[model samples]
Target: MKKFCFAVLSAVMLFGFAHTSFAEDMSPKDIMIKNFFVNRVKDSKSESAMTLINESGQKRERKSTGVSKLQKNGIDNMRLIKFISPADVKGTSNLMIEHSDGDDDIWIYLPALKKVRRLVSSNKGDSFVGSDFSYADVIGYKVQDFEHKITGSENVDGVDCYVIESVPANNKVRQDNGLSKRKSWMRKDNFVTVKGENYDLSGELYKVFKASDIQFVDKENNKWQPMTIEMTNVQVNHKTIVHFSNYKVNTGIDEGYFSQRNLERE
Candidate 1:
């Protein structure tokens, strides 16, 4: 008898074989990779409302539209988000482009300035449009940016999940993300992240994140999307909740839509 070895060359193939008997034997890196691409579609668009609550219980609501599309390589992604309501923040937009081997590019357009400003790596941990979520959270952390290990298993909303802990791979990564470590509860069945805890530079709990109202957006591709996402700052007692609606996937969005010119449009 001869033994043979197989390699997972793509995210789709990796997901396809993840449900087999080898699931239990998969490495933490592979699991993270699967989670990163779980909801990866050719293109998607949606409208969402973000509610920000302060420690004093005051609330501010913002409406926005978002569009994302994968590049030709199918690994990198380009995203653009434009705020549509609230006179103070209206016409503000953000554009992000993912890089497979280096730092992601982020740009912000302010209606008042009428110019696009690029965000440096140090700004990755900064609040996204004054929300509890950061730029890194909006674009997502790259799988290779951290070292991951399965700490344990738990149930999230009655769904079994793998408790994976991730730490920055280097000091640069740590400073860029402003997180010393993070723990995520990834669904066992579909690899969607149901919950997460982000640790600060001092290794203390900083924020709690949760995702709910899961929807099977791309049934043909076995993809799942979360309709609601919440991030709470524990130390400050502030929170941000975003509810997404009217999600459209595989819409063949044009690549030019993510351009800086479009991002600055009113």
Candidate 2:
């Protein structure tokens, strides 16, 4: 009886040590990679309302429908956003094809111009459709493009989070994104970013990003999606609030829908 009890105790101790070691071995980059993969779905469709508030508190609203699909090659994502309302911006659309190995491709169609123009990939730092969010913010910054380290841990909205600091991996990337550094608070349980701070070329706080009203879009897959995302430009006191609704995930979106031809579709 004594030998049997000793064996059981030894087994328990070994298991505990192994678990702790595994947790400690996960680096900040691993955590960020997990966060990136967990939040993204194979395909998604949603309708969203974007509200832009200027320095004087004046507000303008735009509504749009968006669809995203993982490319057939399984290494990239293609997304399309089509504006549906507001007289001036109606029929405006943007299409983005995100590549894992190279710069993303973006095309925008403006109803006023009645032309589809391909945007410079490096112009991702520019404001997205006059909103506080940059193009990079909308399509997401690739995890491999930066080096991340865990600076500390804190609580965001009562949830424990890992505070990670990320910087551009090289001078070219730094210039492309127009950001010196970025910091994000990622929830420990879900690996979702609850808040983020962006620094400009001068290393000044340029924008603040906050995600709230998280909901489980795929409970079976343990996937959580934010219902509301807001980006505030600290220097300009401009803000954009995006509220997502009618979210559908993994609904077999057609890959052809992300093409530039669709950008001009009325």
Candidate 3:
């Protein structure tokens, strides 16, 4: 039984590799599908510094640790992030579990509250830990939930990229992500997104996102990670920048480590 299971797993992994290997003359949806799993490493852990800047140029910084692992199916991902700095926000943690149906389950543990609160779907658009990134952004939008089209092509920092525009397939998806439309600039070389424009619920430009300092964490699997990410809310003149360090992948992190018990623990 074990041997058969192992063989099946190997074939699945090979299929995934083959899917991305032959990428020439692909469609817009094909590109989006490849982008979705571009960095789906088996497991990873990293330390991060998050900075939030307000309209008046005031800044609030916090440190955090994050860990993520792929589920048995090798598609959905489970992630947990815990704050580790600045007296006020310390000991706060968030847990996110991706669902196959495009609806993710999220929970947050606040130190002061001493209880875990489940984040409902309605709150998916709310800011994450007061940062410009929303809960849905943290969890990511499933490819099937949106209709993707190749809008155009452009060069970002000398690298050729494809500008893909995505719109919600239905009202539920739009409300869930609080986004009417999104445009992403993905590199032709690696399919990594370097820039994005997010339109608000009213179909007005709202946030601009930029990613830099890409690192190949899993070279064997062609996995890339962005060391720095910035999201700016143009409407409010506020922004958030997150820098990740000490990033490690495929460390054999135990699945149990992503449980609520660990998220709530100080």
Candidate 4:
């Protein structure tokens, strides 16, 4: 009887192993697409605190309110951010409209200038408001613009993750983002990126990203969101820590709220 029980256990274990292996056989592009879909929210509103620390330990903090809504076509996201704290940056705002097939639209309003300006540049790698994060970091890289391959698998914070390496498909794409390649450790279960390393044109590590404090934002949908995200510039020794709070999902935000006219509205 003991021998029979052992045989059954071994068969179950073998079946489980095969199932896991089959799931992991997905291509890199498929994995990225899955990750993108898993992270997408219908609409969300939140307030966040961004702290920037320099090499010398000097610190600056900015508080902002953000709103994001998915477009009706379900292929784009419109986001607006309004700075509210620190007298120097108060009343400043930025709007980004990310599209599925083309370059994203970006606009900025500076209180000091008292004018709204549209940003039109080929370089999407520029630092965002003097923070370690770049424009690409905010809007995300388009999956179709790059080539992806699974390099290996590893454990991150006790979670199993698939390591994916992404490279631009052409010189134009590489020039636009100012990145030669990027490697990300995506959690196997949820497809969330837990860690990432960005390489520059010279193939040197430029920045590192880490996500933590994950929490369920929509239990019914089995949706998870990260409460804290950190990016560090390796060469400059600068770091930006973003903490999100007061998250409300599926808020039914008006599409017109993402317009440039609304960007300048008080």
Candidate 5:
């Protein structure tokens, strides 16, 4: 009675643990679609996202409110932002993924254009802060963009997920050129990512990243994390709930705090 194996990709490429990669015979719906893209790039010290931006069919009459901080995801970090929505663009300031490949080099710390405006995204399918989520569908990809396969299983909100579909192999990211196809549902007893949907570059259905309110930020261990988040934005219809309040996990943040002048003075 001995069968022990644990290298899980060198403990997730050296101490990250939640790495995720399935199909050794997969089926709890392919380990919940390989732990839903391995917890969608797991590794967090601090994250608080709240983005609400409506810019058409003017009846919510134009809205805005965004606040973020990811501090260390490498590539010169510092993602401390603030834009308290509306009221004439209330004190703008954003700095995300400051510059690794400079794919989404956003920086606009304008105390009324007091400087810092370099959001040159040549069209990674654009539109990130103004909602309808783009900017390469919010910066992500490591372990080579796509080719995971495990397409089967559903029922989402009531558990029983794992319907993975990620398809991007580079026709410049399959012609949509940035984050074209992605659909995940994951959750077979842990792993997270309860549902996701993103399709832009004229394929419609912009963003629908959902998740519920499960706690256990570290309650001795039953390990669950998702206080809330609900980015709608289906083609400028707008919807942002995100309420993950005061979270702190693993706290080790420091890759020079993802610099870019500390993301414009974090």
Candidate 6:
């Protein structure tokens, strides 16, 4: 029984290696989106810094406490709470995640209203809180949602980066669901997604995310670590940006942190 179990596990791992990544053979989009959604995070209490700008020339910033739970079945459920201004989002929680199966769900809890609101919209490209970035871009995506093809590699800011294009699949289940298209640039050496371009409903370039300051936080090895990440909406005139800082990767946050009860609380 043990040998049989090992055989099955080995085969499964091999299959994932084939379809998911053998980085050397990985398509740029495959490498990028995979890491964005399924990369294991540091297990610990982490925090993030967010900056928001709007078309009206107004800017607001907030800091949040983050807890990440990576499930065995290729799912990452993350909860973020705004801690800076209590009244602003006090007791509010945002559920950001990606699942191996099913459409990704983004939910927000409003403290004032004491309501949990699902952020789904008829338009998946809608801006998040008026920021230049759509809510879809911030959350990672399922690997099966799109067709991945390697477009080649090029030097991006002096780093050898893999470039891949992503297009929605034609399967009837996902046809015309509002995410038109996207492109990604993944660094070759570290396998980290450095930048991404989001297309509008009409397949027009609209936003980009740039990642940087990648340093090994726990340093057990290079595979798991935290890095500062920043995203800007370029076609929206570069008027908006979101920044991440003080990132502690692989701190091994408890899985219990992701329970539905906690999702409803502070």
Per-model TM against the reference: 0.92, 0.89, 0.92, 0.89, 0.28, 0.76
Instruction: State the lDDT of candidate 2 residue by residue for 72-121, as single tens digits.
Output: 54436788999998888889999999866567899999889889999998
- Candidate 3 lDDT at 33 equals 67
Ten residues in a row with the worst lDDT in model 4?
12-21
Local distance difference test scores for all models: 0.87, 0.85, 0.87, 0.84, 0.53, 0.60
Worst 10 residues of 2 by lDDT: 12-21
Give me the displacement of residue 208 in model 3, in angstroms.
0.4
Once fitted onto the true fold, the runs of candidate 3 whose alpha carbons sit more than 4 angstroms away are: 1-17
Query: Candidate 1 or 2, higher lDDT?
Result: 1
Off by over 4 Å in 6: 1-15, 18-23, 27-38, 42-44, 55-57, 119-124, 171-177, 218-221, 224-226
**Model 4 C-alpha lDDT per residue in residues 13-107, reported as the tens digit of each score:** 33443344357577787777666655568889999999999999999999999999887655468999999988898999999998664678899
The true-structure Cα RMSD of candidate 3 reads 4.2
Runs of candidate 4 exceeding 4 Å displacement: 1-24
State the weakest 10-residue window (summed lDDT) of model 6: 170-179
lDDT accuracy of residue 249 in candidate 1 = 96
Per-candidate clashes, comma-separated: 0, 0, 0, 0, 6, 10
Q: Which residues of candidate 1, in runs, are more than 4 Å off?
A: 1-22
How do the residues 1-266 of candidate 1 rate in per-residue lDDT, one tens digit apiece? Answer: 11111122344434544554256677788788878877888899999999999999999999999999988766678999999989998999989998765678888898998989988845679999999999888888878779999998999889999999999999988998899999999999888999999999999999999999999999987778999999999999999999999999999889988887798789
Per-residue lDDT tens digits for candidate 5, residues 1-266, read: 11122234323333333323432355333354344233322234443455564555343222323333333332223354555556565556566663333244666777665677876644555665565546554554322345656677788768876677666666665553445677767675675777788765556666788889866565443346677756676665677655656666545555465455644552
lDDT of 3 by residue, 1-266 (tens): 76576556445544654675686776777787677778889999999999999999999999999999998867689999999998899999989998754457888899998999988855677889889998877777676678999988999999999999999999988887889999999999998889999999999999999999999999988899899999999999999999999999999999999898999998
Clash pairs, model 1 backbone: none
